[model samples]
Target: WRNTETSPETLSDSQLRGLGIVEGADGTINFESGIVVTGRVEKILRRDGKLMLIGFSNCSAKQGDRILFDPTWGTFDMAVGERISSVFNGAADKDAYNQIALVPKDRTIKVPSDENRKKLENLYAQVRDIRDRKVGCDRLGEIWETQQAEHAGDWLLSMQIFEILDEAGEQNDLKQKIVTFLNQKKLTNKDISTLIEWGFRLVTYHKVGLQTAAHGA
Candidate 1:
């Protein structure tokens, strides 16, 4: 937090990996800086742009480092929050820190109280910093756009391939261009397989050029 540089390129792979972080591994993704907690992945969710969890609060929890869990099965994160809130107005959403998990308690008794809720609110409000949440729909749209474009490209390549099916003229050149474009789009394994299988052949891909009339090009 002291050195104010957020450029991701600033960190090397080893640096990030050293923090128990791995790229492209799907699990809990911590986009914000906060107390670094490490444990088996538990329930993770987004509530009002704040990433939340349902694991034991004392489990290797720290303050001011981004953390990711492998992901867990449960509605505990929200369920606990809402249940506590319902019983005694435990945690308010306006202040992101007002959550159920942060409540300190004895092992025997479990009851909601305003004082404990306030403490949690005050504690996280001062300590933890939740970042903005990313929209899954937005990411989905990006995938769609890239896929559509690739679909279009395959059609174009098919035309080229069809013409040069019997000759090497310009084939390797077009093939190289296609490879570069595919990498940029981050195509999935299945997408790559399908593209490779029918990319140049362009069977079901859509054409993006001008539609031809009876006497058009």
Candidate 2:
């Protein structure tokens, strides 16, 4: 009845008796073909560490139908359950499929509202104009170009541009404009942390440049 080597078709009468399967008895195979096959259990084999049920069915089963001994079996529902489990466990590859998961909820990047996006775009245009006119602000133009090429949606680059403009002794009017916009804009803690980190890195780079120039002098 449960021999690993016994073929389903070659099951003897004694083997059917051992499995308690009688001819015309109710047997269910959990598959896409959801029909109760009334037949005797021909043989059960443990192949690849899984129980393979071989039986003669009164109804014709399709070729690709998964044969199972019972409807309450775990493997029957594995396909549906695995998908749900992978999403919640964060084991699913985000790039592979566009599924939204509940766990690790904060991983999604919040896109700016249309009004905010328009404001940022306008600010970037003004910054570009300043870069074109200002002598020492060619670096700003390079940064803007890089942002446009790599991540046009990145609003943090605008903040960095404003910082650089203020450092370059730009007009008070522009500085005041930046300050007012920043005060009105609501930034997440993560955004604030990033700005602080970028500011520190900028300061360190400037210090290193000054040290190198002094050594050369």
Candidate 3:
């Protein structure tokens, strides 16, 4: 098990963008285990619509490293069978399998579709207008966070955001909290409806934003 909350957020713009992959940028990365490593990015591969294989070359762990990657689930394992890669003393880059970090894929709850994308965009446009108000709009941030889901390449996180809001909306206490927020902000019933409708879309279609580009899904 590893922790990512404290993982060094330091990475290049490209490395930090989208999936925050560490390849193509020459530098060291600090994992939650506090193990620091430096290497050249070998491959930036996506798998199963939700994870990436961050591969590196000439990699080294701290003087005494404890990080370990299992070999069974990666293409690197096949390299050994083909006899193209080798391992020495369990070194991290002894072969292909040792050099990859399976980074989590960030995307929406459902694979984005053209129809859902347009509806979602229109809904967010309205949501954004509501957020521009002075009060009762903190609830609007939930919708804004969904935009982050699209950028992070993890729609599941986006879906979870909507899920939390939906759960809160179902409960009287939580729903009242949101209602009071809108009242304080002087937002209208239509505003509340838009917020509720956004959640409904998530529960129904589960889209964060329109997928403007094609990603290997």
Candidate 4:
């Protein structure tokens, strides 16, 4: 059995490529494992949703990574035989299975619908916001460790900024934090830049952020 926590034992470059999941003819990425997350093709983004690739979001899933469908009574073992246009690896495109035409493993149902898309988006937004705050806290912690007490106070405020962001429920709400800083007018350009840089770095390194942007579903 493969360990999902640590990286699964390496399957070798060629072995991985040869796996039936590499890329499907109809873009229905079938894996050796039976987990599936589905959604509308949002836009395929690159480098973990930082850039564009074949994308999908707000759909359904099942088994292993199955956040969408629940195969409690049946299995997705049956082949549907529907053709997908383009197949790519990574999470962003996974949702495309809904927006684009797809032959499910069972081929019993058509791709997901707009209703599913919206529902998924709502979930996605909630999760994404949570992840973003975590990233911010991580960044603030890093900067805090390096600064002197004078600068430390502002960084401390940054931590509280995240608290407010958490309660606000949206990224736009971060404006209040920025305004608070501006009103105090205490932070230097260097400090501001450092905070922004660290925030991005935190997102790059944090698992939750990566999962949300990359997979969308």
Candidate 5:
């Protein structure tokens, strides 16, 4: 981890790539004994063929501990206490160092069924039409992007788009579609509770807006 006092809260993609740290690469700190500490690499600093990994561990590590990089699960055996240096040296000798490059696992894109795809396309078209008619409704564009994200297997963004639509007083077919989507999803109890809370907030916001309008009139 970079120094919080000096470094920004988040770094750009280029900066992360420059550090050779793929955010969620799996690693382990193995002791000489049979004990193993599992962790995910947050940041890496490389200097003269040496690497310094900063990450959160399942348990505390003692000084002089080194991590074994295993981006692929079965690439390194923790029982053997294989360090990153030894793995890198061996790879260098074999001229196959690219095989152990730190990178995120390939994500399999979820392809929606034909019916769902048509529905999404229609929703996107409707949002685009609304944008073309309305001059300053930025939330519509955000809704379109969120819908695309949800279709791409990021269902968490649905709540955000829901809140945006509700706040914009758009309780039309688009809002209904979002509600239906949420209902069909396997949401946790906390997620359901949060949706209810957002509903209450929307009601309160509308009530406040109505009262303010009446007073102004």
Candidate 6:
């Protein structure tokens, strides 16, 4: 690897290929220059059963720039050595990559199949009709803090929605924030609906401030 003005942790073609940093494969994420990319480890060239070469399948990146992957699904323009370690070690908190989706280089359009749709529907149902025994009363307290009901019937329904998608790690963090709102005695059914709508909007539409205003904290 040619040593540039970049850090030693910077990714190389050989290293990326070893880690499966393909355009469509799933695995750790990093930056080449400034592009956010996924790294798919195909082989661990380890000696004595220890990991060595981390291969990649593809890289969904543009330039050979470098960026640091924040475990919170956020990225930093400048690379960080520790973050590279975290990516290789798999020590980053799971929720950090929650909001990240499978991004391909081609940016193709995909429609969910019936089975997939049904599965999503089931997840939605879980959030909507949360049972004490199912979702656990203890968990509800933690999930209520992130909900708001400014638009009437939003917060409550939103909580139900979160209960469904709680399996989604990022959404779970967001739900936990909502649950915290509930525990603070600041949530109402109306507020919940508004908050729920906002939550969905943020997830599906990516509207700015949707999550912030909902939390009210």
lDDT of 1 by residue, 54-144 (tens): 3432233323421111123111122222433332233243321222233212122234356655644443232222112212222322332
Q: Which ranges of candidate 3 are over 4 A from the true structure?
A: 1-22, 63-217
Per-candidate local distance difference test: 0.32, 0.41, 0.36, 0.34, 0.41, 0.37
lDDT minimum window of 10 residues, candidate 5: 89-98
Maximum-TM-score candidate: 2
Q: How far out, in Å, is residue 85 in model 4?
A: 54
- TM-scores, all models, native as reference: 0.19, 0.29, 0.24, 0.20, 0.28, 0.22
Candidate 5, superposed: residue stretches over 4 Å from native: 1-157, 167-171, 184-186, 189-192, 199-203, 210-214
**Model 1 misplacement above 4 A:** 1-33, 42-53, 56-58, 65-217
* Residue 2 shift from truth in candidate 1, angstroms: 19
Best-first order by lDDT: 5, 2, 6, 3, 4, 1
Candidate 6 lDDT over 1-217, as tens digits, reads 2223444345555654565443345655533333454444444333333322444444332224222132343221222333332221121222212222222122122333566445434433444445433554444433343223222212333444454455334455656665565444233334323333434533442222334556886
The global Cα lDDT (0 to 1) of model 4 is: 0.34
Q: Could you tell me which residue pairs clash in candidate 2? A: none
Candidate 2 C-alpha lDDT tens digits along 101-150: 11112325544466655554554565555645666565565555554564
Q: Can you write out model 3's per-residue Cα lDDT over 131-192, one digit (the tens) per residue?
A: 33433444555554444444332222233333445533533454444444434432433432
Ranking by TM-score: 2, 5, 3, 6, 4, 1
lDDT of 5: 0.41
Candidate 6 regions exceeding 4 Å error are: 1-10, 18-135, 146-161, 164-217
Residues 106-194, candidate 5, lDDT per residue (tens digit)? 21324456666565555545544554465445556556565656454434345444544665676566667766666655353443344
Residue-pair clash count for candidate 5: 0
